[model samples]
Target: MNRLADKVALITGAARGQGASEAELFAAEGARVVVADILDDPGRETARAVGGEYLHLDVSAPADWEQAAAFVRESFGRLDILVNNAGIAPPRPARFDEIDLAAHLRLFDVNVHGAFYGIRAMLPLLELGHGASVINVSSIDGLAGVGSMASYVASKHALTGLTRSIAIDLGPLGIRVNSIHPGIISTPLVQTVGPARIARLQRTVGRQPLGRMGEPQEIAAMALFLASDEASYCTGAQFTVDGGHLAGPYREPPADPDETLD
Candidate 1:
């Protein structure tokens, strides 16, 4: 019941979806949770429900990270876990050549640089805590190519790289950095891509081994395990909760043999 007893956790994009699930689960397991997000009203509600603090943090802004550092330092004195889960999905499905540079950079600003800023800004407090862990939420796109989500795929790959590099840097300091690659999680982020995109996603996911979309809480459970002492030796690794999407392309179910007598 007390997997994270007495810990302090700060999670970005905690107002809703996977972030919200992580916050609620972290609080339930005894971490003093801090919900950080640009969504003020819902963020506050999440914090209240979890018995945590809500900080309005725009992850793309360095100034906002500075404020978050100060708030964490003042409010908790140290932080045991940091979940850099705040990220933007592809603004629109565009082929690599057709994507606008500025639009692509905008996704990188939040999806890539947001994690970079959060890790840099929170390093001190993380070093101050016991068994500190950093969880960067990447995606299935990070591991492989997607036709139209070039920018998003690139950003997630950058984040994955960051996780690996920083793990080595922080290992000596007793901090572990790892990335989570989630596939087709049912979140508002995905919902924003519109009905047609969603239907396409559903059809695609349906062909995978699990044949279903993942839930936010399921991702949160992986976050919980990494945040806890259970994953002490784990660092600079990619944990994929992808429902076998990466296992292989879908194939028709072959019929069983007509006779088996062994």
Candidate 2:
């Protein structure tokens, strides 16, 4: 079904990984997708693959947003869906005190401020949209605190709050806003942690009920639902696709003492 037929979508960080997956999925669903990112080559490639357009957008830069807004306005006349999926993830988590204050703020620049910029810049277009929706790609860290990764966690939390506030603010205009929190997914960001860190991360997530990472497509599916008219009443909500990671601690069942003879 063409859930997004005739809708116009702009997805940030669509150069690769989750953003790329979202771009592909949106295009397949009949939306005129615009793959936006700072990565020039892959951004263009993703757009080409989807038979859509591309723009060089640095989410952390206000000026870039201005330009992006202009471009989208000129190209599509209005925006239907905006996915703030661009963000940075460190290979390893940083302890609270060990976290560099400035570096942490930079993480906020992208992870948090990026979403802020996207919504503000695209507000006009969204206001003129048919069934406008905003999807902020936060992480599981946004919902719960982690031992390390202080900066990343904080940024995601800020984003989550931003999502709720924006949803309420935009609701009057019929624009829906929501957040997507993903679990340890098998994305390029996950692969960059090196073999040792990868193994450690795997063990860390082993206790989750699903006992495995999620796929980018899984996250895309959730975003698609919100973007479509099916979610007309859904807003200011937190959707988790974390393989039951936020379902609380998973405890193994006790071993059976009797040998089964029956």
Candidate 3:
């Protein structure tokens, strides 16, 4: 149960969804967790539920990142894991040419630059652990394209690149870095895109190999593995938790004739 015993983890966007799941799971495994999010009330509640400390953080703001890192340093004295999980998808679908410039920029600010800021700000504490780990929560959009999610896809792609680059730079120092790509998980984030659209997306997902949407805990499981010593030799890897969405289009095989079997 104590896979992460003696560790300290900071998870951004921990008020809900995959981040909250990771925080709870990490705490269950005996790690001291810091839940950072802009939602003060929900964040505090999540922290209380998980026996973690809550930090108010707007990942797009550099000063917030600095404050969050400082809080972790002062509270825990060292950091063992950083989960860059704060991100925002566009509220509604828009074509490439129809997307608002402000929305696009905001998506990058939180999804891409936020991770960058977190890694830089937490480096000192992470280094203090001597063998810390970083988990960047990208999306299936990061690995492949989804029509109308151009900005989110681009931002996640940038995050994946950053993961690889930093892994190379930090590997010699004993810090492992990796990115996770989750498929359509049932989370509040889905509400932003509207129910009609989400309904259609779910129908599509149901046709995939797993034939179902994933739960937050499933992705949290991946984060836990990446953060643990079990993955000591793993770094700069892209782990996709999608339900075989990337395997290929689901197709029914042709029926075979009895003569063929004979």
Best by TM-score: 1
lDDT of prediction 2? 0.90
Task: Return model 2's CA RMSD, one decimal.
Answer: 3.1
* Top lDDT prediction, candidate number: 1
Model 3's alpha-carbon lDDT is 0.90
Candidate 1 weakest lDDT stretch, 10 residues: 253-262
How close to the true structure is residue 47 of candidate 2, measured as C-alpha lDDT? Answer: 98
Candidate 2 per-residue lDDT, tens place, 97-211, comes to: 9887878888999999989988999999999999799999999999988888888988999999999998889999999999999999999888888988888877757667776
TM-score of each: 0.95, 0.94, 0.94
lDDT of 1 at 39: 97
Candidate 3 stretches with Cα past 4 Å from truth are 252-262
lDDT of 1: 0.93
Model 1 error, position 48 (Å): 0.8
lDDT of each residue in 1-262, candidate 3, tens digit only: 9999989999999999999999999999999999999999999999999998999999999999888877887888989999999999886878888999999999999999999999999998999984799999998889888788788789999999999999999998899999999998988887557779888987778667886788999999999999999999999999999898889786442244332211
Query: What lDDT does the true structure give each of the candidates?
Result: 0.93, 0.90, 0.90
